[model samples]
Target: MRLSAKRHFGIALVVAGALMCLAGAALYVMPGPGFPVLALGLAAVVIGLLLLAALRRE
Candidate 1:
């Protein structure tokens, strides 16, 4: 199963991505479930959304 969400290039998403990345990485150091990798992946997706939204801006 997959979930789809509308892309929105807002600052909030960017912040969330950064937070996720940092936290995930930290967790990874403490013997976690690929949290850093997951964070990076999520950040990448958020970045994509940011780009899409930015382009939409007139």
Candidate 2:
């Protein structure tokens, strides 16, 4: 079945969040700040919730 634009966007956000988390995890073995990337991924998830709410209002 086909998904709506909002649904697709939400899925994309989820994928992005996952990728961010993976990158952050990888960073732990590297040299940068892993915690901040992990926090940003969590923030992206929060933004996804907001996006859903806004979509509902439309």
Candidate 3:
């Protein structure tokens, strides 16, 4: 099946968010600020999920 651009973008957001969360976790173990990154990542993931769900419903 072929995926549309919107789907690709949504997937990209999810993946990028996951990577950001991972980086944030790693930072938390080190000596940097991690909360902001983690929050942004969570937001990105949520937005992506919502977008995907909305698209699926259409």
Candidate 4:
């Protein structure tokens, strides 16, 4: 079956969030990449949340 946009978006959000959590833990060892990873993950989560909200109304 084909995946809906919401599903894909949600998946991305969760994956990104997971990555962010992981990166946060890694910050103690590597601050350079972890900070950027966290930012990207947060952005993904925000975008996904917006997409999910939009989907709900449609």
Candidate 5:
């Protein structure tokens, strides 16, 4: 079945968030400040999950 556009966007956000988290980890290993990126990634993941959940209810 074809997924809705909103669902696709949500999934993209989750994937992007995961990548951001990985980048943040690399930054930490390189002696840079990574907390902000990590926090933003976590937030994006949470928002994406919430969006998915909300769409599922419809």
Candidate 6:
């Protein structure tokens, strides 16, 4: 099946967000702006998922 560019972008965002969240989780134990990273990751994930949802509706 062919995927639309919008869908591809949404998937990329989801993947990047997931990776960021993973990195943040790792940083949490290392001590160094952990909270900020975690927050940013969470925000990215939320935005990405929202984008995905929007794209799916289209």
* TM-score of candidate 5 against the unseen true structure: 0.86
How many pairs in model 5 have backbone atoms within 3 A of each other, for residues 3 or more apart or on separate chains, i.e. clashes?
0
Tell me the spans in candidate 4 whose CA falls farther than 4 Å from its real position: 1-3, 28-32
Q: lDDT, candidate 6, residue 57?
A: 83
Candidate 2 lDDT tens digits, 1-58: 2337876787678778878888988896799899889878877777777776777776
Candidate 2 lDDT at 3 equals: 38
Candidate 5 — which residues are off by over 4 angstroms?
Answer: 1-3
| Tens-digit lDDT string for candidate 1 (4-30) | 233343445666676677777777878
Error of 1 at 40 (Å): 5.9
Best by TM-score: 3
RMSD from true fold, candidate 1: 6.3
In terms of lDDT, the poorest run of 10 residues in model 3 is 1-10
Candidate 3 lDDT, 1-58, residue by residue in tens = 3458889889999999999999888888889999899888888999999888978997
Span of 10 residues, lowest total lDDT, candidate 5? 1-10
lDDT (C-alpha, whole model) for all candidates = 0.63, 0.77, 0.88, 0.71, 0.87, 0.78
Q: Can you write out model 6's per-residue Cα lDDT over 1-58, one digit (the tens) per residue?
A: 3458777777787788788888888888887767777788788778878988887886
The best-first sequence of candidates by TM-score reads: 3, 5, 6, 2, 4, 1
Worst 10 residues of 6 by lDDT: 1-10
Q: In model 1, which regions exceed 4 Å deviation?
A: 1-9, 52-57
Best by lDDT: 3
What C-alpha RMSD separates each model from the true structure?
6.3, 3.9, 2.8, 3.2, 2.8, 2.9
* TM-score-better candidate, 5 vs 6: 5
lDDT leaderboard ranking = 3, 5, 6, 2, 4, 1
Candidate 4 residue lDDT tens string, 1-58: 2348667867788777777867765883675556767666677777777777766686
